[model samples]
Target: MTLDLVNYEQKAHEAVKSFWSNREVAKQKQLLTGKADHGERAGVTAGKNMDGFLALVLDIIQANGLAHAEIHQNRSMLTLPGYFRPTKLWDLLVIYKGELIAAIELKSQVGSFGNNFNNRTEEAIGTAYDLWTAYREEAFGKQPRPFVGWLMMVEDAPKSRCAVRDASPHFPVFGEFEGASYLMRYDLLCQKLVKEQLYTTAALITSTRCAAETGEFSEMSSMTGFRPFVTALAGHVAAAAARLD
Candidate 1:
């Protein structure tokens, strides 16, 4: 890797380490090592962590060829509605070609495999409603907006990988989980939400990927290898977003 990669990872680590430090989630989880509960909150926090990690990823993705957000990019993070609004607010907004092409919500499983998953299912579905409601009201109408959704998670190599199932109908129940893959399990979630006409657009994205520290290249980074990967990924995303025009 280049010196720039090293620098980005270093900065990324600091950012992730400081994540839960936000007053809103300070009590949710401990910084550094991370908090407990291990299910949906972990996913939620991981999503939040991705927000930090993206700083590095977005930088790299821009260099490559992918749409992404930037540090100085014209963007804003706000409360979703009530306490729920801010807590469940969309993570990143990508502006491309003078239009709104996407909205992302990052989530990862930090041992939150059981109960926490259920909670996140609720939050995600609920937040989707909030997003759509906000969207039509000109939340992202500064230009043509594409209704997009992203649900990402960093899961531990589980002892058992469960089969995928579409599980949003059973909301507040099986919606959070059908087996192991929460994101995919809720694969039909976007469709269901759309069917309800909850939102005005149909560009949806939901993916589940795992992360581990294999080639940490350094003792400090032994816990995870996402720092480098995401750093390299940032540039690609940025370049893509810039190209949307």
Candidate 2:
């Protein structure tokens, strides 16, 4: 059967527009209420900045297959057992017939790229490792392996595009990262995540602040692009649905 991608490209454009618009709205709201956070934190502390992307993912799940799957987006229903911790909360979770089908993590970075990039990298690797180890121990019971996905959106700005120097006093860093930009680093991270089997698929996208008006975004590479990400997800969902038939 042909894979149903559900016209994700247009939906992705809309999601990008919503992402920027929501951030601005949140920032303004916080400022008006005298609760503005430091730097770009005010824009993200509202926590609903990614709702559009979440909705897009939900549409893909239902359109491709698994319309009846229980997709958890609420904070309370998103936690799963972890190997190194009591529980870890995911951005989204899919369960059908009492079996886990998929878990996805969605993240974005608008500013503070230097420190936040490192934090995001560590969190992504650690989360995947913890979940996979728990899966190895049958934490989700006797069932097929679930799809794990990670998607990130970064602001396309001069800072993110500029080459950054690595401080390696003792050992030289990898050749690929010697003078890579933050955006390039993220692309490398996503590629390695999939190559290392940390996540079933990892995607990276970039958009400027003006994307709020134009809904424009760019992909760094086809391997880590949004198209491949949704295609893999849709195929997995369709296959899972077939098993139920």
Candidate 2: tens digits of C-alpha lDDT, residues 69-145: 99999999999999899999999999999989999999999989998999999999999999999999999998888
Error of 1 at 142 (Å): 5.5
| Whole-model Cα lDDT of every candidate shown, in order | 0.43, 0.94
Minimum summed lDDT over a 10-residue window in model 2 is located at: 1-10
* Tens-digit lDDT track of model 1 for 1-245: 22234366465445444443332253354444455534334434333445554565444444444433332223344233332254344565554444554455555444444546567667767777676666667655545444344433334334213554444665555434455354344334444544565433222221223112221212112112344234323433443454563
Positional deviation of residue 65's Cα in model 1 after best superposition, in angstroms: 9.0
Candidate 2: stretches off by over 4 Å: none
